[model samples]
Target: MDNDEPLESKTTEETETQPAPQSSDEMLYCEAEVPTPVDKEKAGRENSETDLEIEDTEKLFTTGQKELYTEACKLMGVVPVSCFLRNMEESYMNLNHHGLGPHGTKAIAIALVSNTTVISLEVADNCIMEEGTLSLVEMLQENYYLQELNISDNALGLEGAKIISEFLQRNSSSLFNLQLSGNNFKDDSAELLCQALSANYRIKEIDLSHNQFSDKGGELLGHMLALNVGLLSLDLSWNHLCSQAAMALSNGLKANITLKTLDLSMNGFGNEGAAALAEVLRLNSCLASLDISSNDISTEGVSKISKGLEFNESLKVLKLFLNPISIDGATLLILSIKKNPKSKMENLDISNVMVSEQFVKTLDGVYAVHPQLDVVYKSIQGLSVKKTILQWTNPMKLIQSYADQKEITILDFFKSLSATGAMKMSAGEFWKAMTKQNQVPLNRSQLRELTKRLEDSTGMVDFSVLSVAKP
Candidate 1:
């Protein structure tokens, strides 16, 4: 959409003999590069201190911005509709510690508080540390009109996160999107952020990626993920989430149906974690895009993820870039896709996979069968043949079956399976089956705990006493 190619010419080209369907030859095909938008007015406008209650006007404006005092005076009470405080020169992710200083942030905060029409605020990459964040929260508390907030890439440490989290709890802020990515947030800080995320129902998209989170963030992730149905996308890439953390998120995601895009790339979630997430995919049908690239996963993890693909119908984009999935892993993924009649995946990225030349030839054959789908890999050849794509299955029809069974009845049925004079079974099998049957009124964690308790190696006795009642 950002391309400058004329629509008329594109239409005319399409009207002409339609080009034969082509498959992707390169790993990165048709990757559209969007040129960054440059606002001449904002770029040229001198950064002078806008009219605010704060004193010291002389030191407020930088020497180069001294002349813009007249313009600043005119734009007094009603600042503007959208505020662009982002440093255009710096890359989005490159922001380390460059942002509006405390003084500048404070001044802007004071002015923005009174401005009722100001909807969106973008103050990213300005090293607005704790002091600036405190000042911003002051605005967030009073001004409910502000909808979008971007204070990303600032080295706002633990104190900053605490302030923001505490402020969010007190006030009903109207923010729909929050960008706090690469803020050097610690585990404790991320824990604080989870509260804000769960409370803010208006929030739809959030970026907490590259925060180096640990158990602190993972502990409350299930509750956080479960609370936000409005959220569409979440970025937690490069957060160093271990198997425990990954499992926590997977359990949370078991009931989530709104989140569409998730980026968990570079986290060290091994096969165990990936397998747990696969179980999540069996129940969730809303997530459309998923990225678990560069997580040091092996064929086992890949196989588990492929199994998830077999059950997931909404997923369209999968990124497995720079992982240790070899030819065997690739085969598992391919076979899984082939098995799933309801898989909606159209784009798959498998760059840097360890595969044989024969496997590459196999992909060529797959391309010949499914030319429309973009299957990107290191060694791929374009070909045109019969249309092939994963078709929808009867899963949507069976969705009601998951909920239709009465929880109490299912609990009793499982109890009967291991009851007096019935088939002698392990306590773990009975508990596992009971949990599977009792999906309602119980979160994934609760079910898992029951199953785990039953799995105790000491040959656990009676699970009939376990309560699966609605809380």
Candidate 2:
């Protein structure tokens, strides 16, 4: 045998000493380890090549071409045909790189086509002056398709914010989202934004977080929520919003129905602010998630929120991260969740709050209960004999089938029912009456005719009962 290799005799002896293959049952007990494929080195090389290609393409855009594009954008509407650059058709035309001073945006605005569907434009990190911002606002008023415009991290003061807000009020542009984060927008700017939101309903999400929006801004936003129903999410986190602002917002929540998600995290909302929000939660029925994490909310605030949860059924997620909630507050929350059947909260983020092991155990116990309940006893109970039968059914389904034959909603069907005084009583009472009177109900043809007449009339049915029955 070679010096580097094991001796052939030794190898043969080792093979002989090894155990033989076991029976099928014993073999089944053995676990197999699969080897992982090794292609990481090859992937690294491929990524390096792709990065090189991207760098090479970026180098192809000459400084002169960029300047030409910038000049073309600046002269957009000023010279009519000057805005129709061949390169602008490809992507966003950046004019700030041409060293055109603070008025660079104005140049681009003057060149842009009115009624144009420019999807995105970035003028951020540049010192665009107030006059330049106003010119851009005018451009926004005429243009329709600009969905996103990032002017954050710039020196856009309250004046700039107001200008943009005013343009936003009139522009029926298909802009659904706006980000003005990191701008120094104070209370006045916030008020302008609120007014803009009230007039314009297309924007669904607004990021006013990280601004200098104090109590005044918070109050304005609260009032705006009462009128603006299209907005689904609002981010006002990291603002200097205090208790007064929080209270105003809470009051607005009482009337607002469409808002689903609100982020007020990192705001300095203490116990009083939290208490105000808790009161709003108790009354509101549409909000599903609220993030008040990283605030100065103390145990007293948490206690208020726990009390509110006893009545709140719509809220699903409540974030209280980094709050000062102690064991007592945690215990109260656990007890509330256990006692309240209406509390449908799925997520309770209490991370960093001081809670005891026993409180955690109590919360776990609450989770252990069955989701549904069964009543074993009632004040009155009845039994039937001799094959006597009764059935409880949804009368709406029967009416729906009749309406479906003619293609109409239950509202239309009820309208026709009113002319014949068929719907004089409440829908529940009418349904009960129908069940008691009809041993064998009307034929399909007769039902269809009844639904058709209901659809023909301008009568109305009271749906207050049905509305109240909804969870």
TM-score of 1: 0.59
Whole-model lDDT per candidate: 0.60, 0.60
Q: Could you tell me how far off, in angstroms, the CA of residue 338 lies in candidate 2 after the best superposition?
A: 3.5
Cα-lDDT of candidate 1: 0.60
Tens digits of per-residue lDDT for model 1, 1-471:
112111221422221222222332211111111122211112111232222333344533431221122123212211111112222112231222222355445545655554556676777777677766877777676668778788887878898889878876664677777888888887778778787777765678888887878755775766689876678889999786878888889877876778988999988888887887788777788887889888778888988888888888877778888888877888777667666766666567887765566776665554334332345565423422232112222331232354355543433443564536233345434433444443333322243344454444343434444345442
Please, what's the RMSD in Å of model 1? 19.7
Please, what is the TM-score per model? Answer: 0.59, 0.56
Candidate 2 structure quality by residue, lDDT tens digits, 162-198: 7778777875666676767777888888888889887
Q: Pick the candidate with the highest TM-score.
A: 1
